[model samples]
Target: MNTQLMPSVSVEDITRAHLRLKGIVLDSPLQYSHRLSEIYGANIYLKREDLQEVRSYKIRGAYNNMSLLSDAQRAQGVVCASAGNHSQGMALACAKMGVRGTIFMPSVTPQQKVKKAKAFGKEFVEVVLVGDTYDDAYAEAIKAAETNGWTFVHPFDDLNTIAGQGTVGLEIYSAANFPIHKVVMAIGGGGLSAGVGSFFKALSPETEIIGVEPKGAPSMYESLRAGKIVNLEKIDSFVDGAAVRQVGKINFPIVQEVVKEVILVPEGQVCATMLDLYNEDGIVAEPAGCLSVAALAKLGDIRGQNIVCVIGGGNNDIARTSEIQERALLWAGLKHYFIVEFPQRAGALRDFLHVLGPDDDITHFEYTKKHNRAVGPALVGIQLSDPATYDDTMKRMAESGFKTRAINKDSTLFEMFI
Candidate 1:
């Protein structure tokens, strides 16, 4: 790739952005992760962007972009769409700059984030909950900006936004005591990756830039493969912070040129990483926040190398804990759901229990008795102490002559039942 063909967001632009964001955004710590390093056999460092006041690196971009607005533009106010983090950043920016702003967010966004955004903005911003996804909110936001004649603060597409986000890379490069072999980060609309990746490419040219996207929403991954921006028809919104139908037009080309690879991690794996981060590292990372670390397993042999994983945000809602645990268990194969047909006789359930391993436990059971039929279908959820015993459990069920179908393997059934 020719450096000349790169987008206008140069290292100088990022440096200027760094200066603009100096007092506004925290110089988030770059702390070494002993647990991660011991596990991966690599010197793993975590760029703690989650430590920022908004608990995200988004403040860098949002504040920088808003600060550059002209006097007229500031008076006219600003509009933006975000899943969560950017909204919080913009909300804080609006309050500090004394500029009135309107923020549109997906209805599915975590309530905790929505409340935080409002609290940060106080009287300076209006929160509008519309649509089901970021793309939908973005469409509505764009229309509002045009109709209201307000300055639109793009979450990830604008040059100023990209440059601001690049400050993360600038900090990493400056703070690192040793050479960084790789830097991994989550890609939403590609702003962070494009910004950070470009900085690394220009400065520490040897350091590999790797971007991670949820497997269910691989907008950037698909775009890179097609050699053009590709808009996805649908995406799993579980990783709301990073899930997007399309990568930003301005952010796409820069990422293509600077990023060495984009890894698609399963949403389940992201959940598992979130749990691990919370339990082991005392890090409360949102689903998207743990994406970079979730992807470390896929990076094959990084032993004895210096690596950095950017924890994007700590805006995780405590309400979603049960869902996150369920996802992690499902991904680890420790949990299974099934539709089991059992005879209506009183001893039928007891007989079925014999098929389960000694360590296996039933987590869920729902059954409706059928008056006319000899057998009735029961929804059963089983959790195993060891995932390796799954095959044995299934074999036992087969040998026991019970009619059973696994719901975990069927997406349609899993959604309808689980």
Candidate 2:
């Protein structure tokens, strides 16, 4: 392993980038959240970067890096790989600078995002969907950039990109009238966290900077723990924006130095937070956007403290709403899946149904296989009106003489049948 120290990014770089982005990027608002404050017993402020032109902070870094490109570099054009947000950012930046851009996105990129990126870039940008993951697309993009002699606009890692992203922290501190004790941000390739963490450490030295990652994809956390960049063999892309195999080499040191702590939140918790943001605040947050907010649940007591949660993006696919709701319910213990084998006798289902509490509702029922005068397995998905009824409901099922296996507890069974 190389123990060499890379060049460090400074507040001067961030301030200079902020000046460059003055009229180009919107100065997104920082608003206080009454509901969140009440729930957490803290003065909660949300930095609404989701409301930016590209509906994410990605534009800041993308445009800043491209704008600084020399005339020859711009003429040769630029190429990048992104799952969604960065692609849109680059497309919009290309249009703004009148530069031709090529974006390589994973085939798994949501339709909503692909369309948005193309729409933003219009004639200035070309979108190519290749590979199943962002890493795959990234490799292809690098090859194309090298072969074509085009500037490869890294989504993160580059000093210019990090400096551009640091402007978010500048905005947070500039617009904040009251003192901010802490600022929480979601970590992907560590661009946002590194940028924001560096800014706070430089300007607001007393303020704590915290980074959060999806529990399924804790690349940053794991990397910091191992004292090097660790590539994850697998990750849950449910939170696509933050699901990175490894943190950027350039950004890792900044994160380790400035970030006080890194926390991992379960994907289900992120889903539930997204739902809460939508229902209570009329805010539609993508899974990654909800990372900072979800960390509030893990913080035991933050009463009377002033904290800022950066909501990163709102590029959520409408098609994922149902899946999000299901995950939220499961996380809340309001939904459960069971494989129940019933005796080969008449009224067996009726008997099983009778055991279910009145508050329990049958959401899904399907027979996995047909049986002739023998016990057969049936899949049952039950939704509880109140989560507290889960224990009693399970007790009733156990006493009903039916062989019931809770699929939620058994990962193998759940993955196979559910």
Candidate 3:
């Protein structure tokens, strides 16, 4: 653990970045969210970075970093690694500036984002699919950049990148009619949080800065608690945009200094939030994009408080919707998976069906019969109308003359099956 102080990006630096980004980047809306306000009983505003041309705030930093490159550097080109959003930003930047570049992305990155990155950059950017996570691709990008002497545009952590992200806070402050009580945003590599937090602390000292991270990939959350940077051994890459094994070295110190609190939101809750945003408000937000709003439940008694939640991006792949809904259902306790021993005799399955309540429906079932076995284990998935009835349902199943084991309740089984 290193306790050394790192260079900070000043408010002046962000203001200058804001100036440089004018005309190049859209001033994304700071729109009032009526649905969220009613639910949380707070005056909630959303900084819709998802509405940007590249559907993310990443363009701010990517463009700022690329724009500052000297003519000689631009001619030599640039390199970067991103899960999705940042690559799209860099791709757009490469095309807009006419700079040839290479973008490395994880193999697990959504195809929607991969296509967009290629489309945005056109002939100027080469998209390379590397390992399974951003960190994996980052290593390869770093090596390639070092070998070729190309300018490496870091996704987060660089002074210029932090400054560019800070402009989001500047815009939020400028557009708000009331004094902001709190500013909530997602922390990926800590660039967004560090930049915005620094600006808010300088201009609106009383306004609290809250950083949200996926519980499965709590790099920033763990690092802050440990009082230094702590690299994670593994992470759930479901929230791919924010899923990194470690926060940027430069970003950690700044975030540690400026952010008032950090919240760890479960990946399941993030999925639910994504569905809510889509179904309720007609908003299409990616998983990481929903992190800030997903964290509102953890913030107690924010009634009437003027809050701002930055919606980071909207590059969601339609194909992932089923998985997102499954996660959401599981998190809400409305879904369950179980291993059940069923009698080989006829009518056993029909008798077992009677154990479920009227509102409970079987979502999945897999069974294989054995030649002379008295019983066989079947995998069953059930969805309930009310989570409160889970215990009652389990009790009924136990008394129904069938052996059963709840997969959802067992961590090992949950990971293996679900």
* Highest-scoring model, lDDT: 1
Worst 10 residues of 1 by lDDT: 1-10
Report model 1's TM-score to 2 decimal places. Answer: 0.98
The backbone clash count of each candidate, in order, is 0, 0, 0
TM-score of 3: 0.98
For candidate 2, the lDDT comes to 0.90
Spell out the clash pairs found in candidate 3: none
Residue-by-residue lDDT tens digits, candidate 3, 1-418: 3535567888899999999999878899998999999999999999999999999999999999887899999999899999999999999999988999999999999999999999999999999999999999999999999999999999997989999999999999899879999999999999899999989888898999999999999999999999888999999999998999999999988898799999999998999999999999999999999899999999999998999999999999999999999999999999999999988889998999987999999999999886678889999999999999999999999889799999887989888877
Tell how far residue 120 is off in model 2, in angstroms.
0.3
TM-score each candidate. Answer: 0.98, 0.96, 0.98
RMSD of each: 1.1, 1.8, 1.5
The models' CA-based lDDT, in order, is 0.94, 0.90, 0.93
Ranking by lDDT: 1, 3, 2
As a whole number from 0 to 100, the lDDT of residue 78 in candidate 3 is 98
